[model samples]
Target: MIVKPCIAVSAAVGLTSSALVGALHASGPGGLPRGARGTATRGGQGMEATGSGFDLGDWFKQAFTPQTAAAVKKKAGTSTAKKAKAPSGRGCTDAVLVLGGTGKTGQKVVEALLKQKRDVVVASRSKESAAELYDASTPGLFVQSGVDVRDEATLKNKALFDGVTQVVSALGPRFGEEGSSSEAVDFQGVQSAIEAAEAFLEQGDGSSAAPGDQERVLVAPGDSGSDERGPGGAWQPLDDVIMGGRSSSAWQKGVGGGVLERQSGKTFGRWAGTLVTEGGGFCGTVIKDMPFDATGYDGIRIRVRGDGSRYKFRLKPDTKLDNTAERQYQAPFDTVKGEWIEVDLPFESFVAVKRNYVDFNAPRVNEGPAGGKMLSLGLVLSRFGFNEYPNPKYTAGAFQLDLMEISLYKKPRPNFVLVSSASAERYHRLTEEERKNDIPIVALNPGGILNWKYKAETSLRKSSLRHCVVRATGLIAEGKEGDESVRLQMGQGDTLSGRVSREEVGSTVAAALSSSYSAGKTFELRRDEAEDATGKTPDFTSLFRGLVLDEDRSLASAGGASLPLPPFAIVQDPPPPVTEERKQEILNDPRVKARTAASKKPE
Candidate 1:
């Protein structure tokens, strides 16, 4: 009797009666093992199924028949042939939350991570007037409950922390919203969110907060808090990167200090200009004053990359969360070019007496050794010893340097985020290979990307960021949708719609524009970039010019009241077709009346 090894046996014949699957030792075409795992297989006439298109289970079982098992086992080690385990637990780091997670920048960061298979949690920093940044695209990402972020317990979600990483912030002010004090998340509830993150990390619930490697992984380092966000306000860290390593011997000349230069590699200028303000006080850094607390965390460390140029770090006059006064400190560092270095500032540096830090228009509230103060790290480019000074050789100008990273590490390379693989896959299928890789096809959508080549597959499939831009210009040159190829460029907009496929390009000119525009109605949801390239900003002139072209055919069909000629020319009303009474009677039958009527009405 011929025996079949790969297929599962019927209930009547259990495993006892069934044979085990076997594997071949040799490599097959495409470098796959000859069989599924180097397991034993039952190979005979019953299991001689053809190769290609077999189900995964069948492929595994059939390829591992006893006839080839010994060869496979000997050729490859038992461990190398083992099937890898699947990833489990939460999708992202433990409680990977974003304060402004739904905001334009926040969404980008979140999506970038999510596309990398990270689970994300999101929340609006406030309760009212929030933009539509938050929406349904979110699946594995979680949204926090309620608007108040101060209450740690409220933001604590086990599902988030079950497999979470960090708390991030990408929220920013909407246009014209910056005037309101609420525009700055930095001053208000952001601190509350930070406190919540601290609580979450400490209770043994956030073990996934840190990442081990710089590239293969990114750490959570806890949540982020923000403020001073605006159109020109810039991303908070960017501002810090440019201004953190400032130094000077004196105040500006206008304010009675020596000259300062705005170039790179140049240090202090001539003469000992009092580090103090002309009024003998502190006035340089953007500082805050109020009852302060660091909880139990250590001192702040500023991370930046600089050429082997000297830089001075400073502190603020009033530590109050509301105080704007800052004083310079005497710490210096000769930084190497293009490498990250950490500068640690102990709290004790600024606590000294004689309180010479404050020098500004604002007078001292109370005298005796100005008690209220805190260190605010900031840079000073122009000052007494900065540029044109007696110390002529001192160099530091518009520093040609880029800042890549920054953080307040507690100790030497503090493991702010620890990484452990709750689950891992040995082979991560690249994007391009995803489709051709033949994953579950039914699981994907019609227009879904078949290729998963990071940027490789991108070039293969139709869309190109550069081409998307170039084609947009091309389509614009065409003036109207009908005049252009409409080849999936300028995706559906607020105007009408497109089929999202060739067949859907509105069978007619007017239909294509009117239909496709309506399809991509949510284009406005995007902020940093336009929903559709044209909508980058609303311009009726371009829209009119682009849509209403020299060829007014499309507009006319949509009842535009403009068009020199119809899409289809008039037939000149051909002489009334010859009709006889008997012939017309048969065509007029009610059963198929509509077609007969249309046929009789005109050519």
Candidate 2:
């Protein structure tokens, strides 16, 4: 399909921004941030926010002190407001650096800065054949600097940190890539970025450096101060975005935006100490991580908007305490759903002099027995209201923010640029405009980004993103001398209750399915009348609920049984094969075993 020029342009510029490009991991497809999120009710679609540019130096000056300036920036020179060409990335720092940029969050940072017209460089080892990679380029937004992240030189290359002020790392290990210990990319990557910044700042001559002799780190912090910073619309400086003012209730937590329901003219949200007005705001957090350098800079700033309800800003910094424990930060905001309100936090508000939230490395626990920092930001729609009587008429309308612009310096920085796109800059640059329209199909393990087997296959042109299922059965091909395929899509627990009794064919079908669905959402088998079935298809929705989300799938044929769990499912960790004894137990479960037995007595 021809991508509209407007969207293509926004995506082009956004993807090309260094901030955006760097934030993206080498992960594929959903590899990096693109400044927007997918909303299901909206058909997984959204409007674009074109990021524009600003003067970085001006903003930098306004926000930092000379000491910070000397430590972060190498050039004592000036920033030209007239869209100066970005610093030529000629010299690499002695430190190896990883740019973990991209996704909705990183996209905003990159495009906002790029609107200021910064040259963006993205690095991820694309496994496209050399021929394919060259042809698959997205111009304007992509300057492919192929750097192997696993290599030490990636960090030590001095050319990376030229004119670099602060290192704002938006790095995090993605869904499939992190090893048990590789999560350290955050702890270690930030340190390396610091080393590079230092080398860049101290390059050429032994210049008199920073006042405190410490490098200022630009990390996304977890909490804010707890003091009472009284006000109406002065913006609350906390990282909490809540669903409803946080109820100590577990049932309502993951229900999306169900926390606050407005009935009649009055709306009531409940929490310990949050109050609401026509323009109140709230933020609840699901923090997972934070940086080591906690107190060197100013407090946190976040962008917010919603039907104004009294909001409570919660913080969960990782310290000696368990992860779920939360301390309230100053919660204030005069919010209107349609606008982006900036909340500036003076570190003083978030300071809990006695209780600090910092846990360097804690064992990861489910209910969060394993604690980290408050890396997550949540929202609660209502809190601290007059009455909970006739639950007020609730409006479930949706609210969204294009980007959160956080200025960490004590004040705004002078000469800093706020770059944005004509439509969320750089999203366009992700795909090869030359090839985006021609993306006939994409394989799940395409380029082998995830080391799992049973590659997922789907078409780009279909309305339903979950278009088709692809599998390499290595099947015993006896069909008219070649290979052919048939795809089936059904809801969870819905099954094709075929009464065929062939155990071999049932097992083959199970094998085929196992190659496709790993540990994913629930899905049931359905018999589509439209499908040209070689035999009778099974009833889908009515039979397959319990078998959907399992690590393995069990099916019961008339005479024998088989289990089909797509390779993606984690059945008995990749090693130490499951003993046949356990396999029998799986098939024995009445809920899991599919009720199809295949043809007329083929046993």
Candidate 3:
């Protein structure tokens, strides 16, 4: 007589009742009779043993090893596998230059960058001040004083750009100052930095992989006799005719129909047409099946010369929705009439819409695997703005938009990151109660700081380099020392009002440098008092993920309308009102006093 071997296995091995039954029938000694097979239970579907001499558990233990057990765990969808690692910084050697490095926020930025193990060059008007502020023995720290951004010659110093791949402009204007006015420091100073950065890109540092080299050029002038289609794919017109409109448009490649001409030994494309308001008013050109993975990019940068009219750059994601062709993500940009201008459109600014109406619940354009993938792109001259609003800059007539090149850029990595104030846009809308309760300088709008900061931001938006503008709310100046348990709260449309610590602001800026989520986007940031009690550290990734991209607020149609505020735990107890003595204390703060004193003298 043959004796059947007993088998035993742990339930944790993830073997199902069906699998055990199959194994028993296929591998059991002489196969168990049908009547002797175990019964399957509900829920977990575990098997019940019969009186048969064979033990399936013992057999499973003998058949499975640790590796096989792990495999089974994974196959059963219950494995505790580690998540994929996050993307790291550009490189270890890529130096970052920090303007105003000795200032309060700037100092915080410097500390955070050092913590990230990045090489930092501190640019200040006074080198001695920076040297005194930062430790001399600190690793990856360099101080370069006498580098005023107002003077174009000063920013052109080759030493500043040596190994420098990114720039963080923490510079702010001195209120009530003469030479150190907003135009000088806030606007033109940023302009000077952008020009210097562009010049640096043009003059390579002999490194094969330069900062701008990785740009994904979608549409560009090709060699003579080359195909009319660009690297972006075929160009076709999708005019208002589809909706029974009278508007007419076409995509002209090279010198076709006398619409475009060859320049600098290369040909260009033109989207020229007549936009009529009869029935509908819109003209556009699109390229379909253009597979572009804009995962680590800020947004699309276009070099175009147009008729001074506002035009919309639209995109459609690679999705299976039935109305994919009708739905799009668009951002409007104002064009220069006669001269060529490079418009940097960040991915965050693109608004989701269906048939020209804003869709608040629609999925973000860059919201899928690999950041996000695109199926098509188009340029539209439309009379309708978001949510059926009128395009304030729209004009109905013969129009021509000349396109030279289109490409994608990474933000804060190869771009300038500017730290401005949220009050720049909301100063005019502040409530009397808010003004009284807010910080002194913010309420006073000292030296027209609001206007100047807005001007500076506008200049950076129109510049050629990719950029991110972080508009921070009133900062909690006091108690920043040793208070490392703060959480961050961010919002769009400048509707948020609260106090954030300088440490949190600096941490946010440093976090933005390595995160693609912060590129080509603008938002208001503050500290979350409600979260302070949770004892959890701030999650910069989650904070940035909740932000919405900006639309061109310069448009008259895009007035003080704020987007829905991001979710924040309500603060049960608001901080006490600032007393008269407290206000004086804030004004007497070292940074504040220095700026106030400097305003009395000419730079």
Candidate 4:
């Protein structure tokens, strides 16, 4: 009658007194679990102990209690209920995009989104891999192959952003991966995404569109307002400056400023302005605030679509016209109505002048010390004859000049540009002395992106997309990091290195889609120390919460600069004479036949 429950249980289990004592030692007193050290009540007497916060009685109950299916389900229901308490419509959506979906980071990002029950569109260069990665039977997951962001035609394709709400680019270069370099995937790829986002927002799916539904995601560059004029320097309209003429009838407007207007078909900037040069007065607009340093550029270029009129493309060394130190240079070019033509205004072709009339014989104004730095550029309706006096050329009436792009070029500037994540300064492995010496930074090297990181950042900043730039540390493929114990760590100063699972990076990108707070932010991520042994999906929302949201370039604080890249080299070669005997000799080689046979072997 006085037998304790523990003694009775031990007897049932066929345990001796010594064995019971040993089992009790392992489970602690009264069969309570380890780390259950605290105040306990036994036989109406209080007992004190010190250890974990967990109560001993609660631990014992959990350990001894046998759970039924109903009870297990009830616990799961409790967790589900807790999850339901989160903000409504804050979870994953039908359309999420992973741009470099086949890449290490991109592939992980795709999986993370799918696990959250969100539909994902995986975009990569290879169609087969993209299609093969995920099964079509799984609802909401899709694949897009043969997509190259560096190519505008592919980006402008309507199928690219179909029903897509968010885009996460894990697109980047790995060592030895050919064709997809940092420039192609990181910088240029990002820029393309930005452009696509702008287009998507502008042209919502031909139905009732909400502002939130219209929004998409991607990242690009930033502007310093120093050195590079940024994207703003790409086109400076006539409205930015003052327009003056002898005739009051002359007026100008910055109309149709299209960066990339695919809507309604036409897609080019049209600088439509009226030039009525009555009373023999010259009409023109001065772009005095041209802050760009045109150093290394051979000349300025303008794309014009205008009425057949002789116009003077002018440049000034100084900003002020009142100062005697200022010198003006003008080049006259004839335009064809309705036809777009590029007019190149080289410094060598410019005629220098002290007034509106130029002295063509005066040694071309010496181009000055700032030969390439043309501070002020202008478009003018100049007089027909510049012999001894200025005489009016065209009739005084309505005139228009359609301007597409204005740029400074040595060779023609590329229509598109690609950049690398290694462009970030901290990523540069080079020392200050090496950077100063202007060495070439190879993309395959550890810190290859320093030369182009800034460029990529700048491109993103100039883009139309609302973006979240997450610069991650060294990426580790899934199995490479052992088990999936990914604890996201965010910081600055480029201090964190080691390896982070690509899947973790993907999960973070997927989480970013749900938060508008992530927009206009740049942060760094790395994997923390191991947390558990078992493989489990990380808490993406919690990881995203750790993002710094700071725009500061972490690398700048580290005091690193990009190494100078070598100029483009042209290697010309004469064509080899085609000979049938040489071709046959190569084709009939035994080694070639063996290699061909080996390749043909079934996989």
Model 1 lDDT per residue over 1-603, tens place? 111101000000001000001111101212211212112111210111111111223322322221222111112232222221112432433344444443222333444555545444444332111212233344454344344333344455444334333434322222112121121222223334344444443222213223221111011111123122111122112121233333323222311132233224322111122232222122133222212223222233445455554554444444343343333343334467656565654333223212333233342221113433333434332223322232221243334222322233321111111100000010122233442232122111111111111121112112211011000000010011222223233311221111121111112111211121121111101111223443232221123223322123345453244443223121121112223552343234232233223222321
Candidate RMSDs in order: 27.3, 26.1, 24.9, 26.5
lDDT of each residue in 281-319, candidate 2, tens digit only: 332322234322233233455554444433433343544
Ranking, lDDT, top scorer first? 3, 4, 2, 1
Highest lDDT against the true fold, candidate:
3
Candidates' lDDT values, in order? 0.25, 0.26, 0.57, 0.42
* Of candidates 4 and 1, the better by lDDT: 4
Q: Model 4, residue 265: displacement in angstroms?
A: 43
Q: What lDDT score is found at residue 440 in candidate 1?
A: 22
Best by TM-score: 3
TM-scores of the candidates are 0.20, 0.21, 0.43, 0.37
Candidate 2's TM-score: 0.21
Which window of ten consecutive residues has the lowest lDDT sum in model 4? 6-15
Alpha carbon lDDT of residue 529, candidate 3? 56
